[model samples]
Target: MLFTKGGDGKVIPRCRIKPLSAKNVVVEGRDIDVQTFLKVYRQRVHGLRFIFDKNVRRRSDLASEFEGRIVLTLKIASSGEVENVQIKLTTIAENSPFSAINEDVKESVSHWKFPKTKNGATFSFPISFYMMLPQPSMFDDSSSIKNK
Candidate 1:
């Protein structure tokens, strides 16, 4: 998804998600090719996101609502275990609501798994969170209707 801040009261995401470089993908011991592994790895990681929302709500560091990009670099072992997850870049600030999402993001990343390969692989991907902003009422006197 791509995002661009709009001057005319609109929000369009303009971010690009790049697949892992072929040279970075390895499947020595496994029977699958690099392309197939990449597909599977992506699917697995996206599926893991379902579990993140539930865990994130428990935290109160900040209200987790923002429209921006968060890129994460991950290293996976040959045994399908995630070795590391690092914040490559983020358009949102840490003091913002994104801080509340940090633990949930880590928790989600930890659950990502892939088939065992002869050697582990390292790659990066971006996850975008977006929502529409609330607009003010069209009429200023609308509140007077209820007051009467």
Candidate 2:
């Protein structure tokens, strides 16, 4: 019988037919089942990441040296464009180059390209960069000499 009585006493169709029509073709022209397509599409739309360069710098004025980490979180659009970029966290060295670091991050992130989703949906991800300044020797009399 094309329909059978289930435990719930409802008549359910035993056979379902999917037509191989051009209009029903999947994104990549593959004949994928509805459930599998949804699962893969969801994953692709949500998978996003940010990668930071290793040369980020941290600058501080008080310590007479620069030091810190630059944490950036980028929100990408479905079109694979960067919609927004925020500094998630900041670390500074006493004498590091803060302005230069900021500028560098801005320029670098602007050049990044995110992967686009199959359905043309955009996503966002967070990335971090670390920069540290070398510590001066404790026994170095440079600070005392400079103060004089």
Candidate 3:
């Protein structure tokens, strides 16, 4: 049980703030708050993935050989709109050709849609990119010979 200072300066159990209801969901020791948090988290993750995929498709020229992590902080409004977006290139390599990847992700994430809540919230997450290399054609053995 969690305790907090009450209005009268007495330590009160935090759970006293809200009475349990029949509609409240609980799993293990978690209460409605945990369930709500999980729902919101899943929704936000799904939205981010959708936005990332859409933006990646728009930038087909992104280098596939580079691996990097982009950290993004988003301020989401209660109306489910993205209010502000902050991008930090946390794992970019020096003099990399994909220097603009962070900007690209930032621009794409700005259009992300999240579930509206009763109050606005701030969320920060890291997006890691490990692009797959294009497969060489099996019939293109002549290209290898020419290089040798």
For each candidate in the order shown, give its overall lDDT on alpha carbons. 0.54, 0.38, 0.50
Q: TM-score for every candidate vs. truth?
A: 0.52, 0.35, 0.49
Candidate 1 structure, TM-score to reference = 0.52
For model 2, what is the C-alpha lDDT against the true structure?
0.38
Root-mean-square deviation of every model:
9.9, 26.7, 21.1
Q: Write the per-residue lDDT of candidate 1 for residues 1-148, one digit (tens) a residue.
A: 2223347744332212244555654333333356765676577544434333333333322212434566777777878778788877777667754464555666677777677867777766666654432234422346665544
lDDT of 3 by residue, 69-120 (tens): 7666767677767788787446765455545556665776677665566765
lDDT of 2 by residue, 24-90 (tens): 3223322333344334323432121111112221112222232345445554455556566666555
Worst 10 residues of 2 by lDDT: 48-57
Better of 1 and 2 by TM-score: 1
Q: By summed lDDT, which 10 consecutive residues of candidate 1 come out lowest?
A: 55-64
Which model, 2 or 3, shows the larger TM-score?
Answer: 3
- Rank all candidate structures by their lDDT, best first, as comma-separated numbers: 1, 3, 2
